[model samples]
Target: MTSAVTGRRRLMGAGLGAVAAALAGCSGRSGPVPRLRLATGPQGGPYNAFGRALARAVAESGGRLEVVPVATAASVDNLRRLDEGSVDLALSMADAAEDAALGREPFARRAPVTALARVYVNYTHLLVPAAGPARSVADLAGRPLAAGAAGSGVQVLAGRLLGAAGLTGGPAPADERQLGLAESAAALRAGTVDAVFWSGGVPTPALTDLARELPLRFLPLDGYAGALRERYGPVYTAVTLPAGAYGLTGPVGTIGVGNYLLAREDVAVSPAGELLRVLFDRRRDLLREVTAGVRLEPRFAISTGAVPLHPGAAAYYRSVYG
Candidate 1:
């Protein structure tokens, strides 16, 4: 078999061993392995890939857990699913999670979501044609722009950025188009869209692919960070995108929001603890599959602002540190 096939077989072997152990662990008081549904994002997206990797790790850790990765519209949708009790675990943007907790727009009322960990940072990316007319987000006014999908976290952030530029309603002369990441990239390349606003981890594979096809520019969002922070909350932070990241000419400045791994408040503590343990224990395997998984550091994981930590997550942290 090929190396790729060999690796998968090895992983499966580990997972089976873990399942056997899990059965043994459940022989006494706790009945059986916990089955959980994890809501991830669209296919080929960071959240989706992250969720799959996590599921694999949980299966390989000899833990009594069954993690099901469900593909959805990302942050906003994930939160909704968790709230409606369709899923037990989810990955969401800090801003959306905060909004859900506060019963803000897009959410009808408060949600019972609690944080498991702050996993990574999603940087705001304002991609424009290298030879296009727009120099900044403001310049895109009156131009064709592709925001994220309508109900997506991208749309939420895109609206906020547009508002920051003082281009609300008819003030901004732009045709706002809402599209998914891949579609947005395609539209930009086809000259159908002037700009695309994407919030994701650095070196996003899709953007990297688009850059190779056409010259592109990274417009900075640093200027509006303060305004966004003041208006939104502590979730927005100014961050520097290093030079050569995505083959950019120099370091670019942008706003970043923490990405959180969340669970419903009612989730069983033991299962949640086991899931967290499996994540850290099989870090090497997960990292091999996703670069974003590197952000799953223990110290950083506990800093989920505004969102309360799940009891099981707290127990796991205590077990590791104390």
Candidate 2:
């Protein structure tokens, strides 16, 4: 639980007030404070848990800052909210952030969003009934599938993988439904959906609960990592969900996508700096809610790939790296 992030006395050229605030974070705030909204994911998801945890940590510190967590579709939805200034901070997948930054398919134009930190990796999960006839991604050609919630990173990745498997835009495309993780789990339990696509930290609470309640099987996605990386970039990685995760007897190979904390281009330096300081200083407290946060560290946090870091984040990194 100790911070691997050590800082030198040098301010890394950041504004004096900003760097001081960041370093002095966690002290209970006095009176009025700046309120910032953070866009997280749907209920029962990692983003939601992390957002609430961060808010609580800041609150417990009695800081002069207030962070509010807003539930959304996650990833792309978060980025869109950031673009419109509806939210000051957001949690997003690196891939979706890249797509939005580069004006990719779902995004007609580039978005003005910047990174705060690389939080963790999301392990893609394609779960089906254990005893169901469908055994592979291709087997669900004509079946009903929960393709993730609307405007979510899960849906974006699911579409690409499904199209590559020839399950979409075919003679009998999979009937797709836009459902969030909780809704997808409910739909699967009701037998209304044959398979559900979820991309989040391993042992996502909802998925873990679902696994224990109903026998479930994870479909292997080991084959598409290379293709997705080739077509897109290094944002995709081949990772395996080890045995015992979700109480599974065997390992499941899947695609792992980087998750990032981001902010709008216009976010001021003080709020951003204060948040970063609190994040590194109080990360262990965050892990009580989102276990994936255990993976967050100074060095790893700086690797946001194609997305540029916010000015405050850059300063924080410089202070640590120096």
Candidate 3:
């Protein structure tokens, strides 16, 4: 594994160990700490880092719970893991979660999961070589493009963006690449691909690193938000990346979709409530580290779109907001 993945695994293992030690001395009153498995995204993506922070927070909260972070393909794969009972919680894009709840294309039947909270907004990044010929989504037609990995939420958003731009398969249909964030960045740097569609938070780690090594620009997609939402539901929204967010000169307008933290319906109410309490109580600790965690506010936390909130999550919101 890469150093980053190893680091995340070590962080989670340490958290679990701490929880186990704490629970062992608890006089057997509450029994062993409740172990909850969280399905996170690929190593280089934001979800993995954020999940590790959450696991650490829960471990330190003195609550009767232990969170284990499991790295997996994002969204589609995470939801599948939740359905299979392999994971207790997952992070997913609002659209994908809605599809799973409604028994849509990628899902064969409704999934038994409930939303814990709405997390950050993932911006659709149409990244291109600064000196390359492509100036807009239209310019990328027939050119090489990386639309994220096959099972990732980025791939779904990429298809929607390309379709909105009237580029069904674009030019050189075979040139469309389905690569992960790390692979996509390397492909762009090596001149293997002309452009890439990455739907992620502003200043994505790989993109930020790539920008330092090469000149890059984000194409505006604010115009397509309407059409995208009209077809895909209200899950799509307009979001802006301010100037200097990723060392860019000016603000870039883009389309974004909310990310939801979900849990299986069977997870107990008390542990779920404790998880949310620790999440917000230690929010600043997370914000100081992960930029994506900055969006985890209590107000936006309740906006989970069509997915219903878990009973424990609902109680947490009520106790705080009331």
The models' CA-based lDDT, in order, is 0.81, 0.82, 0.79
Question: Could you give candidate 3's per-residue lDDT for residues 1-322 as a string of tens digits?
Answer: 4442353233334443344443343234456677899998998578888889899988887777899988888988999898899999999888889888777868899998788888777888888889887777887777778988877888888888888887876444425688998999999999999988887777677788899999998889899999988987789999887788768899998988888889998987667777887888886666444454356666788766567777667656655554
Clashes (N, CA, C under 3 Å) per candidate: 3, 4, 1
Worst 10-residue lDDT window for candidate 3 reads 4-13
Question: What does the lDDT read for residue 266 in candidate 3?
Answer: 93
Report the number of backbone clashes for model 1. 3
Worst-scoring 10-residue span by lDDT in model 1: 4-13
| Candidate 2 residue lDDT tens string, 194-257 | 9999988777888888988889999999899888998988899999998998878989899999
Name model 3 segments beyond 4 Å from true: 1-29, 169-174
Per-residue lDDT tens digits for candidate 1, residues 219-269, read 989999999889878789999877887788799999998889999999977
Model 1 Cα shift for residue 109 (angstroms): 0.9
Best by lDDT: 2
TM-score to true structure, per model: 0.88, 0.88, 0.87
Better of 2 and 3 by lDDT: 2
Model 2: lDDT equals 0.82
Report the Cα lDDT for residue 306, model 1. Answer: 64
Model 1 lDDT, residue 193, Cα: 92
